[model samples]
Target: MRPGGSRLECCATDLRPRPPPPPSSSPQDPAIPSGPSLPPAPALRDLAGRLRRLPPSCGPVRLIGVDGHAGSGKSTFAGRLARALGGAPVLHLDDIASHEELFGWTGRLLAQVVEPLGRGETAHYRPYDWRTRRFGPPRALPPAPVILVEGVGAGRRALRPWLAALLWLELPAEQAWARGRDRDGEEQRAFWDGWVPAERRHFRDDPSRPHADLLVRPGHSVHEGYDVLPGPAGTAGQGPDSHRT
Candidate 1:
């Protein structure tokens, strides 16, 4: 059945909800070393390689989820990873989320994407356009060898069964929100004020990372001040032979 609903509004922890990547690390991000020491570069490369080899967690296709706080870099990482995987398909949560629905798009996702993917059929969804605050045209997602679901609750309870790997982008709430606010700027401050707390409550009720198989934090610092650090914590919490980050 097709799902239909509207998202709820929220009051902020701070109505004044004022909100990177680097070599080594930065205050916004913490360096979490894996149990066994491996060179940073090789470790990440191995992760990508292993993901490629893992038997499809969902049917014959690997349904990897890159979940984390908003502005935690899920979208950016998912895009690059898709490129690495030779143009893999990525289903962005932003498409499902609307100005009113926000995180309430799960039902729409299940009805539109997950169920179809389970049948190895194409999934269709009308992505929500934020600027105009309306859903765009229906997008068809083919059953590829791998499909990425990246967003805040990509690993939520409702979608777990369909996932081959659940990856959490390890960025704290404060730091993550700060970046989000900075990126969106003061113009959207009102929207963000409501968003931060709503996000907090959403994570509180339906947490994703605790059960994640791996946690990715990728970036590095250059001679220029822009720090780019790409580090991931490998921890596939469950699955008999699943790996840990």
Candidate 2:
């Protein structure tokens, strides 16, 4: 609500390590640990290949939605994944959101970005400037083979049907919010105070996890890569409803 109403035009990695087998109880067999073992993470190349092969979700573009709580490393992870996909274009939701309409920019996105891309045309949007609290000149996003939409509510119900695959960062809200608050620091403390409740309310009413195709867990180190697991919504190959347009 900075200037435009609800219709405002605004706006991966892989590592695998095998643990040594547990000591054998008898000479015949090794005793497995009672604790569950996580499946090996897919290589980054492998994940990229899989994503590239998905059916186009928006016209000629495979619109990949990378959704998660703020400061959950969605941007960092999406950057890596975009590199893996050979420099896919990324559209940050931050560019679409204004201070006044934190989670209310859905309609603007659909009209300015999604609709044009859906019709195999270039999408132009004016990115929001948080500091100035105003929108800048229009920017263009061509329909690429793969385009990543990364932000907090990328997987909201309204946008899910158009996603080739929805990815959720598997980080708890408290920890994620803490990281966000710290990153924003004391200067933006008041903003964070308002943001936390708004984010909570948004998720409570329209949770994205239940509709995510994959849950991405970051590794401990930069080179360690990420662990990707199937989410409650569906697996990679199982397409969501495509007829919805």
The best candidate by lDDT is: 2
Q: Which digits, one per residue and each the tens of the lDDT, describe model 2 over residues 80-170?
A: 6676677789897878988788899999999999999999999999988776778899999999988999888999988877788888888
RMSD of each: 11.7, 14.4
Model 1, span 115-141: residue lDDT tens: 888888888999776667677888999
List residue ranges in candidate 1 displaced over 4 A: 1-45, 218-245
Runs with alpha carbons beyond 4 Å of true place in candidate 2: 1-42, 236-245
lDDT of each: 0.61, 0.69
Model 2, C-alpha of 169: deviation from truth (Å): 0.3
lDDT of 2: 0.69
TM-score of every model?
Answer: 0.73, 0.79
